[model samples]
Structure formats: structure tokens, C-alpha cells
Target: MKIKLLFFFIVTLISLSANAQTEVADQPAGLEGLISSRTAQRKNPDAKMDGYHILIIFDENRSKAEAIRNKFIAEFSNKYDADVIWDEPNFKVYVGVFKTKLEAQELLNLVKDNYPTAILVKDKLKFPKI
Candidate 1:
């Protein structure tokens, strides 16, 4: 019985040791560049990404822009994120953070009749909410 238990313990230890070994694969050539780029991006929290947004209102009056933004928010509910940005003389109402123009165009098509002047504008956009 003592010999049998010792044999079982030895076999278990050998199996565990064998299973502990890990195989390493060669990293891709571009992996270092990608890692460095990601590290740089992480270091800059305010770094903006180039993307598209649907421009709903571009008016010189702040009140009018706010009114339009309110109307859009009421209509769309919580379906999108809307913002009223002041750019010098004009206050702009931009909607959605889209990675591609096609995505912005899709929303624009749905919004076109309500806002005839709505158009896709290429700009620095916020990251989409998780």
C-alpha cells in the first residue's frame, strides 16, 4: 500500500510538471510598431480621432441652435448623443460619433426630411460609448 501511494504521487507530480511547460511562438514583425503606436495613443488622453458626424444645425444664434438641439433630442430621445458646439460666430448642433461616413449617411437619410440642410461633416469625434 505504501509503494502504491508513492508511485501514484510520483506519477501525479510528473504529469503536473509536464503540463506546466508553455510553448512560445515568434511575434509578428509589425507587433512592435503596433504596440508602440498603442502606447503613444494611451499617453495622450485628449487625442481626437478623425471621424464623421451629422451636422443638424449651423446657426449664428446660440438660442436658435439650442432650440434646434432641444427639438432633435426630443425627437430622437436617447437614441443618440447630441451636442451644441460654439465655433466662433456659429453654434453647431452635431449628432453621433461614427467611424465611417457611411454610418453617418445612414443616420442622415433618416434625418434628411426633418432637417433638409443636414449633411455629413468630417471632424474630430469622441469615442463611442460602450
Candidate 2:
């Protein structure tokens, strides 16, 4: 009986081991070439996409814009991101990286009481992490 039990156990183990082998799926044609070409070209690390931001302040004075940016950072930095961009002669202060105009509008509505002139501006935005 012990001999029969041991033989059954060995047979089960062998069968299980045999079934454990995985088969590799066939790669589609041109996938390897595409991957190689992509690797050669190299992707941008800081990839940006078309998005919207709340234009909080746009002024000709850099100092004024910087001051408003600092104020915004102090008040709402936890909720949103803020930046002071130099667009030629004027300094523009923007907030939030919204993927859609509706999302930007939502935040804009909330902040409208404080910044009455806040409007949504479409621009390149940092890609969100998964």
C-alpha cells in the first residue's frame, strides 16, 4: 500500500511539473521593428499633453505676478499646482493641470469668488501618472 501511494504521488508530481511549462505567444509582425525604432528615437521623460489651466493672473509687471503666485501658493497649494510663466513682455500666472476644460471650469468656479477674472486656458500639461 505504501509503495502504491508513493508511486501515485510521484506520478502526480511529474504530471504537475509537465503542465507547469508556459508557451510563449507569437509576436505580431513589425512590433519588434517598431520597438527598436522607438528605442532609437527615445521618448521624452517629461511628456506633456493638450490640457487646460485656470488663468488666475496675467500682468505686465513680473513682480506683481510673482506676488500673486506666492499668494496663490500659500492659499491653495495643497489643492492645485501654480506657475508664473513669462510670455514675452507680460507675466502670466496659472494654476492647476486639468485634463479637460470642464475639470478646469470646476476649479475655476470654486476660485471665482477670490479671483473673479479667472478663466480657463488650453495649454500643454504634464502627463498624469498611473
Candidate 3:
């Protein structure tokens, strides 16, 4: 009778441990699903599309252009919440998608201090649909 009780206790402990582990394992899938769904929503442009737009043109031949681009990204990433992208033939950096030209111009003035040669241009920004 004592041996039978010990065996039953071991089995109960193992079953309880297995159930606890399953509950913990189940948590990450829900969190991962939430993250993946949010990412999918962001990929849907129709879900959210409205912001400032600005273009920055850099000297393609200048070696310092890359350094300048990095600096601009570091400095403005949080302050202005800008997006910097590299377009072929030139390192094209763009800030927010402003509703009006004036708003873009204002941001240009703020960023130009760091990048003296940076100038504003008109070009449509493109990002791969996620």
C-alpha cells in the first residue's frame, strides 16, 4: 500500500509539472500572434496612411555623404521621427510626410544645420508593401 501511494504521488507530481510547462509554453504563441498581426496591419497601407513628406539629396561622389547620412539618422530619428532611405545613384534621405510644402521646408531648415550640403527635392517616397 505504501509503494502504491508513492507511485501515485510521483505520477501526480509529473502530471502537474507537465501542465504547468504547457501553460507557460502557451503564453509566447499568443504574444507572438499579437506581434505578427500588428506587423501585418502596419504593412497594410490602407490601415494607416497620412503624414509629412520631404526629400534630401546628397552628393553621390562625396565620401562624407555616408557619414552625413548616418549622423542625420542618429540625430533626427527620435527628435523628428524621420525615416532615412537610400535610393540608388544618390543617398536620398526623407523625413516625415508633411501635409504641405511649408512643413517639409521647416524640417529641412532644422536638419540642414547638421548637413550643410543637404537640400530639399521633390520625389515620391517608396517602401515595399509589407
**How far is each candidate from the true structure, as Cα RMSD in Å?**
4.3, 4.2, 11.1
Measured on C-alpha atoms, candidate 1 has an lDDT of 0.88
Clash number for each model: 0, 0, 7
Q: 1-130 in candidate 1: lDDT tens per residue?
A: 9999999999999999999859888899999999999878756767678899999979999999999998998999968888999999899999888988898899999899999999899998655656
Superposed model 3: Cα runs more than 4 Å off: 1-52, 57-66, 81-86, 125-130
Please give the distance, in angstroms, between residue 48's alpha carbon in candidate 3 and its true position after superposition: 10
Per-candidate TM-scores read: 0.73, 0.64, 0.42
Q: Least lDDT summed over 10 consecutive residues: which range in candidate 3?
A: 121-130
lDDT for model 3 comes to 0.61
Cα-based RMSD of candidate 1: 4.3
TM-score winner between 1 and 2, please give it.
1
Compared to the true structure, candidate 2 yields what TM-score? Answer: 0.64
Deviation of model 1 at 93, angstroms: 0.7
- lDDT score, residue 102, model 1? 90
Candidate 1 — which pairs collide? none
Question: Candidate 3: which pairs clash?
Answer: 51-97, 52-96, 52-97, 52-98, 53-96, 53-97, 53-98
Model 3, 116: alpha-carbon shift in Å? 2.5
Q: Is candidate 1 or candidate 3 better by lDDT?
A: 1
In terms of TM-score, the best-performing candidate is: 1
